[model samples]
Every structure is written in structure tokens, then in C-alpha cells.
Target: MFNVPAITWTLTAVLLLSGSYHFLQATKSHQLTDRVNNILHALMNILMAAMLWNLVPSTMLAQIAVLAGAALWFVIQAVARPEFKMLCAGSQGRLKCVYHSLSMAGAAVMVAMMGLATTGHAPAGALPMAHAHHSMTPAAPSTAAATLGHSPGLAIVLTLLFGAAAVVFILLVLRFGAAKTSHRHGTASGRSARTAHGLEAIGAAVMALMFATMLA
Candidate 1:
């Protein structure tokens, strides 16, 4: 969880919107793999939004397990042979799958970190807003915030990982936007793809910011 209320709400809004978009796409997609991918992304975004407010503490372990499985699913798709028509097929598709794997893995780690931080500090299913939004200064940390801030090494690693991913995704969004103008016939699909990349960029940046705050 983040200390800054504005950042928290902004992330929550973006995640919810992204999750809703992916959920709708999942419902609409005809391809099995695409549907599964969309569903995983939707769940990841929604759960991440919930995490910002420390919602559903009782389901923390379950969330982590599901996200870890989703990560593995993406990894399998990325490594699958071309003969596996149900999985990622081409080089670009596999690369995208790899990114998806990392995203899911990152989400799982985040859930785990929150779970560890919140343990013994709040009752199951309780909303501990104060614990989530406590001052970052060591002198007045809530119990949960104290736990989160102690692991500087892990936080630094996660911050860098998500930051780099955000930069890459933002570049992809720009590239997609530039290409969209040259390909008139693919405008709709191109726009949708760019939107996806933009959402990914935003999500990754949020993750980076949250982890960076743990260093405070």
C-alpha cells in the first residue's frame, strides 16, 4: 500500500478501468488462449487495485497462489513450441507472453509482501486504512508500514524492475501510435493495442512508485 492518497486513488482508478476493459475483452474473444490471457490480466489488475486499500486480507494467500499460477501459465505460453497452436506462436507473441509472465509474477510478489506486512496487525477481512496510509518516517510507522519499509533491498529490486518495464511499455505505446497513422486500415486495432500498452505503462509505473515508497 502507498502512503499518498492521490497516488493510491489514481492507481485504483486506472487499475479498475484496465481490469474492466480486459474482462470485457475476455468475454468477447473467440480464441481460447486470448480469452485466458485477458482473464488473467483482468484478475491481476483488479486484485492489485484491491491491494492498494488492503481489501480482502483473508484471501491474501489465495490471491498469491492464483497470481503465481497465472505467471507460470504465461511462462509456459512463452516457451511453448510453434506446434502448440493454442499458445503464443510467433516471436513477438512470445515476447509479449514473457512480459505478461513478469507482470503476473510481480503481482504475486506484491501480494505476498502485503500479506507479510499486514500479518498480526489487522483482523481478517478488516480494512486498516491507517495502517496502509501511515507516515513513511521511521518515528511514526504503523505496524504494517514498518514491516514494509524494512526490506529495502527487495523494494529497490522491484522498483527498478517495474520502472524499466514501464519505460519499455511507454515506448511501445509511442511506437504503436506512430505506426497507427501510417496504417489506415489497421487504425482500430492499432488504437486498441496502443491503449493496452498505455495501460501497461501506467500499471508498471504505479508498481514502481509503490515499491519506491517502501524505501522511504
Candidate 2:
């Protein structure tokens, strides 16, 4: 759990820089997609950071503020660039925004959940999983069971969802290898964008594993 928080901070820092780059490039190039992407990612980073750090006013309303802001930015982007097909990938641009939107919400909710667990507000079922206090022997079978026994349903659901997403992104990275430029981006810019997508896939896969490990 603690390690995940550290990784989250590192990832958010990188995204902060990446989002700023898009925003700055958009300002210079006057590219509609870049502008929209900037806003979308900016909100994403903010919401993610807010949730991870357990910032003040940590209520659903604040979470909605961040998510609603991202959704509104998305709407504006779609309206501004009706032909904006690719959010961050080359050929497979389907449901990119939807994935991002859901991720934002998840980040916020995870923050709240973690906060609850930390404050001892979590339900009784979560206590064993949280403290691992069910046994004294490290090698006890009961200990192993306790690690995963409380959240079988949620573990299965999240594991499958994230596992599939990881597989899809990995295939996309492979497919993007010899792929032609779907958009009119220049050679350097196009390569950079595809590389970013590959990185995104890697990040998603790793995050999925983290969640699975925690639940398992």
C-alpha cells in the first residue's frame, strides 16, 4: 500500500510534465487536438494527485469537481475538433477518452477508500486485510488466506478488467509498430505520440498488477 503511493506520486510528476508539454506545444502550434489533450490530461493529473494525497475537503463533491471539469473539457474538445479521433494512439483510438474518464474517477475514489481504511472507518471485513493480524506465524495458511479472503469479488472484478486493458494496450503497441500515420502529424511528432501510447500501456499493466497484488 505504501509503495503504491510512492509510485503514484512519481507517475503524477511525469504526467504533470507531459501535460505541460502538450499545453505549451498547443499554444505554439495552435493545434486543436493538442489543446484538448492538454486540458484533459491536466485535470487528470490534478484529480489523481488530489486523491492520492488525501487533500482537504476530501468529499465526493470535490471528487466530482475534478471529474466534472475533465468531462467538460472533453466535451469542449469534441465540439472544437469534431474530427479528433485519436486521443493518444495511432490507429486504435476507440474509447480512449472513456478509459481516461473512468481512470480519473477511480483515482479519486481510491483516495477516499484509502483514507477510510487509514482512519479505521473501513468495514469490519477490511480489517483483516488491512492489518494482516489474523495469524502469528508468517507461513501460516490462515495468513495466506487472510491476504485474499476478504475481497474475492472485488479482486476478481478489478483483476480481470485491468488485465484485459493491459493486454489490449500491449497489442496496440505491437500493432503501432509498422503502422502508418493515421493523422497528419509530422514524422517526429508521430513517433513521439506512438511511443507515448506504448508507455501508457506499460503503465496501465503495472498498475493493474499492483492492484491485483493488493487484493490477492
Candidate 3:
């Protein structure tokens, strides 16, 4: 009977739709690589949404729905496109795939942990506020208590996974730049690179903000 925070849920939905827009653009472009990237991007957004949603004190059913939806999307993409599967098997693609896979796994663990915490299945030591009421607690300790009391493990794991994803994404972008460099130099290449760079920056910023908020 847990409910999702309205602000976080709204932001999650917005990010999800933004990813969906990218997929739609890829479909219109009719390029196989672009389409595959867009689909994978969409999957990442969905995974993110599910992760954030799981942080809320929600029921196991909601958590299952989110994880199952992400798994189903990944499975469908893997089965429906041989090229995409091949990309995932490649070195660079594997890096990106592994990052996302770890993200999904971390999200699942977080959801399970949240469920356990809510249902009193977690260890008593896992509770954040257990010993904060003592008279000898330092000011720094109290500050830490205020900030870290809520699921610090989940926040740390999520941040690490997201950072890994961003690093892999940057590497992929560099690979794309190197490939484009060998081709005929043109204004179109510059324009496209600029656009891609802007999008990547925006995505990174949003993710950073999300991670910061989780810590808060």
C-alpha cells in the first residue's frame, strides 16, 4: 500500500516520454543503427523510471510490474533484431549493455530491499534512525543522520551504476566520433555531432540531478 511521490513520479514519466520521443525520431529516420540506439535508450529510461519508482514505499506488485516490463522490453529487442543482438555482443555495445544490465539488477535489488524494509523483513541494524536519539551524537553525525538515514545502500549502488552507464555512453560517443572522422568531412557531420553532444549532456545532467536527489 505504498504510494509513489508525486514529484518523482512525474519526473520519471517525463523522462520516459522523452525517451519514447527519441524512439519515434529513430523510426522516422529509418536507419537501423539509429533505431536500435533509440530503442536501447528507451529501455534505459524505463529502467530508470522503475528504479526511482521502486525507491518509493510501494507494494511488491508495483515493483514486479516495473522490473517485468523492463525485462520484457529487453527480451523483445533481443529477439526481434538480429543486428541489435550482434551490437550487444560487440565490445562497445557490451559495455553499454552491461552498464544497463547492472542498473536493472541494482534496481531490482533496491526494490526487494525496500519491500523487505517495509515488511519488517530487513535486519534491525538496517534501519537508519535507530541510534540517532542519543545525547552524545555529534552535529556532523546528526547531519549525516538526516541525509543518510533513508536507504543509503540503494543510493550508493544506483549512483555507481549510473556513473558506469555515463562513462560507457561517453566511450560510445567517442567511438562514433572516430568513425565519423574517417568519412568525408562535411557540415552535416558537425551539426549532427553537436546535436548528439547536446542530447548526451542533457541526459547526463538529468541523471546527475536524479542521483543527487536520491541522496538528499
Candidate 4:
């Protein structure tokens, strides 16, 4: 009844439309990098939606629908932008490489969890309760049902990491937006400035939502 699939579909639609707009701008300017980045961002959003949908207690039909939608989006990205395949092909920075590697690993884990959940093989008690119902249950536990049995230490570590990443994302968005604005007002060329501005705003909104959800 939580209907996570609907939420995911809505988010995916937003990302797809945004990505399409960015892609059009990139084509007009011949900016391959911007196009690639936009496509990747779209793919990431779809994958995230799938991951969230998998977390909800849904029927196998619903889970399959979510997975299929995400997979279709991913395939479109791969076909449209083959260059993204080299994102981590030859990277050599120890910290940066490790960070990206871990991120990908985490995404994989989330996808696998979704699959298991769909098949009813996932660990029990992993779905969050409706906030509206909380007030009616006086003895309800503070910890989310979805996170019950999870290691507190791991949760803390992940919180710190996600928090730091959120900050860095905010800074990058600000810097990118400023650079784009400066270029747009006859100060410089600032190719793909508009796309950067859009991404910055999206990143900020996403971070805010994540922070709020974490607190809740």
C-alpha cells in the first residue's frame, strides 16, 4: 500500500525529461561531456528509483515493473552514449577511485536487495511504516521498522559518509552554478553553463530531501 513504484516512476519521469532537455542543449553546443554527464545522471536517478521501489513491500508484478522500467532507461543510456563506459576504465587516483568503486558496489548491493525483496527472500522487517499511522501507535518504536536489526555502527559510518558527500555535492553545485551565471551574462562563453545550473539545483534539492528523510 506504500506505492513506492509510483513515486519511483514519477522521479524517473522527471529525470528523463531533465536529461532530455540537457541532451538537446548539449547537441546544439556540441558538448559531448555535458551530454554524457546528463545521460549518466539520468541513469543514476532511474537506478535509485529502482532501489527505493525494491525496498518497499510490493507484489512481484510491481517489482518486475519497476525493474523493467529502470532497465529500459539504462539500455537507452548505453545505446545513446557509449563513451560513458570508460568512466572508471583507467582511473588512477587512489581515494577517488576507491570512492567511485564503493559507490558502484553499493548500488549493486541495493539492486540485489531489491531482487531478493521482490522474490520474498529478503530479510524480514525492512519496510518503513507510514508516518501518518505513527501517532496512533503510542508504543511504536523510534527506530524505523525497515532498519531494524541493522548494525548501528554501520549506520553511523554510512551517515557520516553520506553527510560529507552531500556537503561536497552542495559546494560543487554552487561553484558550477556561479560559473554558469558568470558566463551567461556576456562575461564568458561558459559552454554548457545552463546544464550545470540545472544539475546544481537538482543536486541541492536531492540533498535536502535526503537529509529530511534521514532525520525523519
Name the candidate that leads on lDDT: 1
**lDDT values of the candidates?**
0.82, 0.54, 0.55, 0.45
Clashes of each: 0, 0, 0, 0
lDDT of 2 by residue, 118-144 (tens): 443433444465458446543453343
lDDT of 1 by residue, 90-150 (tens): 9988998998898898888787677667664433443455446555433343465456536
lDDT of 2 at 208: 57
lDDT of 3 by residue, 1-216 (tens): 124477676768666876786777678766675576577566556655665655445445455455555554444443444465534554544544454444444445545544554454332343454356444553444354343335666676666656655665577567667666887453676656645554554455456546545554
Better of 1 and 4 by lDDT: 1
lDDT of 2: 0.54
User: TM-scores, in order shown?
Assistant: 0.82, 0.55, 0.46, 0.42
lDDT of 3: 0.55
Task: Write candidate 4's Cα lDDT for 110-193 as tens digits.
Answer: 444335433433333333443446578633443432343233444344445655655765575567667667766533344345
The per-residue C-alpha lDDT of model 3 at residue 137 equals 51
TM-score pick, better of 2 and 3: 2
TM-score winner, 1 or 4:
1
- Of 2 and 3, which scores higher on lDDT? 3
> Which candidate has the highest TM-score of all?
1
